[model samples]
Target: MADAVTEFVLTPEQQDLRRAVRRFCAERLGEDTVRRLAESGTGHDPALWARLGGELGVLGLAVPEELGGAGGGLVDQAVVAEEFGAALVPGPVLGTVGLAVPALVALAGAGLDEDLLASLVEGARTAAFAVPDRGGRFDPALVTVTETGGALTGEVRHVVDGTADVLLVAARTGEEIGLFLTDGGERIPLSTLDRTRRQATVRFSATPARALAVGAGAEQAITAALRVGGALLAAEQVGGAQRMLDRTVAYAGTRLQFGRPIGSFQAVKHRCADMLVLVEHARSTAFHAAWALQDGTDDPDLAVAVAQATCSQAYQQVAQESVQLHGGIGFTWEHAAHLYLKRAVTDAALLGSAAEHRERIAQLVLDGASASGGVRVATG
Candidate 1:
């Protein structure tokens, strides 16, 4: 039985949207389409992205309605992200929706850059969020870029949405950090584990940039945006893991050995069952985190962290098991199982590893206790 509370999370309209996206991905974003796009060296089809943005209204899902967005909010993003993950839909959707939109939304709250935000909302433009990669984490300390005489000079690694029309840079200015909207630079694409998504290094060589926001306001907005990004990523991971589990289980029920389906064996049955548990756990955590973040619940950060840590491991485990349970054929290049595994591992390390998130979770709990005076010590 489904939980009553969870059932209402998606209104009738949202449910319809999910069904529509699932159908589109099934009909258009097929395995062949994804493979062809990957091999074409572009790794993304502008036509497909345009359809999604112009027709489905995904590009502007997070933006405010006054600025031309659907104003669907974070939960809506999570729902769409899950479908994207399930189909392994390849493109800059993750970067455009997850990172850049949040930055704009945050900036919008502070009443800055309405024109830029409007352009993005109309799908006429796109932006990639660039943050210095610090050992698999987006640590503020990694930002060492400086601005002088209106020219920005710094480098940020592992920027998502390689096809973005612009860059939303998180840069450091002396002791204060700020964000800048740049006209993009040379994008050095890196060979990443997942070919479905694109990433690159953007080097600013005295690049002329326009500042979006500065000081405390910029910091708060960016932080909130990144947190939403991390939570939505967990939703993606959960969706991918679910797809892998479904594929593995279906294969198990059909593949025969010694005149019997392999699924009949005790060992194989256990593996499939375990995979189900992982997928379910991942789904629950991802949805809860999305809800908390969307509703602005108390301690949203803690909820997001818990979801990131729990869902990361769940997705990785199911993806890894999927390959092994599929036997010899799963090891071949023709098999899609390996691709899911690669994506799983890559997404696990995107914001931070499960282990790293666990560390943060512990710190958050302790810090919260101390802040609220929840801790007590008695000594003679």
Candidate 2:
């Protein structure tokens, strides 16, 4: 059997990509800009998004070269995603890159929707995955939208980036689930915990849609997209947790109490140390999942479940701790601590809660055991 887990290190090219993304975020996605975008109606800046896709080619990192992408893998995409999370860059990145693009690529496989994919890669268009779930779970079995004669009708709630230019919807027909691509839907934006991310209720009224995949093929595409989303989300959580840790440590070292730095206190020191431990653990699990997805490990589902479960809890804990460590200032609206804290809480519930992923992990392990009559041991 193949190794269940392997050491994952960034290549020289990936390292350079990371540095470049960091520099871009530092210069463009400052606190003021993030706040501005969050408060805006669309919660996105098209020009900035264009720069990220056209200039950096980040949106297409995981797409194949023949499909007009950068011809990179999930790991490369995760690197960019991590930076986006750390900077709290507000946009449709999670929906477009993490969900829609993967589903489209899987269903099309360079055979269909080439124009749409190219437009997305160039930042000329954005798309959202309309899975009918309010709790961030993407179970193809739960899809309620129905497709008939090439038209789709149903309502999907709590859709991430639901206001995008395109919609990739999962619809059912006579017990067979399929993916359909549509251009317009009645969108009602919903207020959410994290203003940085957008959600909506989309109603499709016999909307003409192009079928991407049907029956088993559609299920496979949806599953592939969800797994990729879960893994990349874990990487994003790691980035957010790391940032919270960095900020907390810096504040603790400078903030004074009793004429000595707060960081000098044992309690504060211990808290920061704990945050560091969580951040590092989260980083390891997240990147490992990315590698598994990219390399097609024997059990990518298990790896994704582990990463999502670990990273979600770690990010929430670190963000909450960062706020507590900062005292009253952290609770204020003007401070950045609350923003990261909100993002952490929202993200914990985004791709699925830690508890949910743990349940998935349990099921996957049990299934694997049942299939082989015993658990397969890792050889390397």
- Give model 1 RMSD, 1 decimal: 4.2
In model 2, which runs have C-alpha deviations exceeding 4 angstroms?
1-6, 109-111, 133-138, 366-380
All candidates' TM-scores?
0.92, 0.95
State in Å the error of residue 350, model 2. Answer: 1.6
**Model 1 TM-score relative to the real fold:** 0.92
Give lDDT tens digits, candidate 2, residues 1-380: 32443346688999999999999999999999999999999898999999999998899999999888899999899999899999998989878999888887886653259889899998889899887542345566578899999998999988989999999899997778888899888999999999999999999898999888888888778787888888888999899899889988999889999999999999999999999999998988888888877876646777887898999999999999999999999999989998998899988888788998888777677656755487643221
Q: For residues 1-380, write the lDDT of model 1, one tens digit per residue.
A: 23435533688877898899899999999988888877667678877877888888876776678766887777787888899999888877667778777877888756467877766665667678886543234567778667776678877778877557888787777678888888856788988888888888888888887788888876776777677788888989988999999999999999999999999999999999999998888877777777766665435666677778988899889988998989999898999998888889888888777888788777767654675577422110
Off by over 4 Å in 1: 1-9, 109-111, 133-138, 370-380
TM-score of structure candidate 2: 0.95
